[model samples]
Target: MEVYHLYSGGKDSSLAAWILERMGYDVKLVTISFGLLDNWRHAKETAERLGFEHQVLYLPRDTLKKAAEMCIQDGHPNNAIQFIHERALEAVAKIADRISDGTRRDDRVPFLDLPKTRSLEDRFSVAYIRPLLGLGYKTIRELTEMLFIVKIRESEELQKADYEVELRYLLREKGIDPLGIFPRRHYQSRVLGWKTEETR
Candidate 1:
């Protein structure tokens, strides 16, 4: 079946797509853009390198700002991030019957709660899949390193590509410190041009 994969152009999403492809699923990568600020460029580039059909869907600027505002109000990003993620999934569900994301077992924020997960599946008549849900950080990192050549960096430096990055920008614009809301030391990876010959 064709699966619309929520892609971030980061290691985890890339790996999820790769695994789904290997499992013989028809995979199309979809990246959500919140208004003007998004990692669409990087995501498109990575999709080209990985040879996947890719597209960017836009979310309203106000929606993203509201989510950011919630984070600011709550003094934590968990709820806001989860809200944004669900919104993105909702958008994808409209386009495909099979929806998936790069969310792993170790992920905290942006994870759907049981009720929300069931609601999404029931409402959309779609299957929500998380291929990396059973994989730990070390396992994913090792697999990523073995399968592709990547450049790692602190997630903050990855430009306007991630939801957190946009949220941080919104918070800063409102004169709030994002550091006070989010945890320290999140990392993101980019495909540095090629996959290993072994994975070919």
Candidate 2:
């Protein structure tokens, strides 16, 4: 079965690609570049290292700028980050449609939550598969090691940059993890602006 995997060059996505290939499925990799210097390099190297045919989708800067503005105007709880993420997903979904889906065209987008950002992009047509959800970061490391997969070296620009750490730092500054106020998926909300009410 032919399937297209969203390639982020992260441990999770890399491991997902490895697992899918081992399962006897024909998987192609697609990476969307939002013009982030660090992200572009990472995606390029990961695709080459794994020897998978990869394609790059360029995202316009204005799209991101507009998303950021919408977040601020709408009082999106997280700010500009979430907007960027949603825009990326939307861009990927559009690209995914252009690619032919052989067997897995019905695959669905896996979201940490049920709603909110669920429909930001259409993953079904791309046959998006989330094979790494059952696996943790440590397991991903072990698999890469066992399979001799080369770990992606972070660019010097991102050497000390950790988005999760940055998120917590801001939460600390705000004196709130805001769990009681937002849904679980919004754990990244501090980084991505979408906010969800717990009861909803």
Candidate 3:
């Protein structure tokens, strides 16, 4: 089946797309833009490197603002992040027969709650897949290490990809410190390139 995989150009999303491709699913990569700052450019570059068809979609600025507001009001990002993620999925589901994301076993925010998951499946009549849902960080690390040459960096140090980065920007613009809402020391991985047989 054709699957639209939500991609952030990070290792987890990349690996999820790779796995889906290997499993013989026709996979297309999509990056959602919340505001002016989006990781779509890097996501496009990664899609090109991985040989997949890619597209960019925009989430309404009003929706993003509401999410940011919720984050600030709650003094945490979990609910807001989940709201944005679900909205993105809902948007993608309209255009694709199946939708997937890189949400892993341990992901906190941007994860669909059980009710939301069931609602999407029932209402949309589309499958919502998360290939990495059963895999934890350790297994993901080992898989990436075995499959690709990767560079690791703190999420804050990266080139502003992913929803958290954009959300952080939104928070800052409103004079709310992101660090107060988000945890410290989140890390993201970039796939430098594929590992060759000789290196393996």
Candidate 4:
């Protein structure tokens, strides 16, 4: 009954965890850190607001560095992002019987295709869950608003701890500026707290 959800302090992941908890699972929030940045505290703070047990899991730094290199070579971050996400799932699966993420139906990067999803389940002997997979942007937005207060900001704002920030830092270390490599106007949500006391 314990489900360890990969959390990022963002609306999608937050809603996913909330829904899983409501479904009778003991949802514990988890964030993956590649040891590149110290911003994981933001996620911890958000988890506190959500009233969920939270923990941080560290992934191999070398893989993240490799992913940064991938960004420069590929001229886009889709493959690198997806690579880190899948690796994160595998990392969590090692200590989780049920693993979940906030990826929605419209997410392009950091998405697990059907084959990868099945492979993850079979290889790890763990159930991978995506509570928002069947929900689109509009519905997820409405659901989040009804249950929690969220703030939307550009991805560069870094209100939440996520893999992209780490990749950006790595790219910078390699003398490759991340300003143009990643999209400029990408926006994400940060769950501040519950809009209603009863929901919390």
- Pairs of residues clashing in candidate 2: 78-193, 79-193, 82-192, 82-193
What's the count of clashing pairs in each model shown? 0, 4, 0, 0
Compute the lDDT of residue 101 as modeled in candidate 1: 96
Ranked by lDDT from best down, the candidates are 4, 3, 1, 2
Off by over 4 Å in 3: 198-200
Per-residue lDDT of candidate 1, residues 1-200 (tens digit): 99999987888899999999999999999988876665677888888888999999888888788898898789988889888999999999998999999998988877886798999999999999999999998999888887877878876676525677778888988899887888778666777445667654
Q: Give the clash count for model 3.
A: 0
Q: Best to worst by TM-score, what's the order?
A: 4, 3, 1, 2
My TM-score estimates for the predictions, one after another, are: 0.91, 0.54, 0.92, 0.95
Model 4: per-residue Cα lDDT over 1-200, one tens digit each: 99999999988899999999989999989898988787788899999998999999999998898899889998888889999998999999999899999999998988989998999999999999999999988999788889988888888875679888888888888898887688888887788998987654
lDDT (CA) per prediction: 0.85, 0.47, 0.85, 0.90
Model 2: lowest-lDDT 10 consecutive positions: 186-195
Give per-residue CA lDDT, model 3, range 11-92, as digits (tens): 8888999899998999999999975685668778877877889999898988889989998899888898888888999999
Which of the two candidates, 2 or 4, achieves a greater lDDT against the reference?
4
| The 10-residue segment with the lowest total lDDT in model 3 | 154-163
TM-score-superior candidate, 1 or 4? 4
RMSD of each: 2.1, 11.8, 1.7, 1.8
Count of backbone collisions within predicted model 2: 4
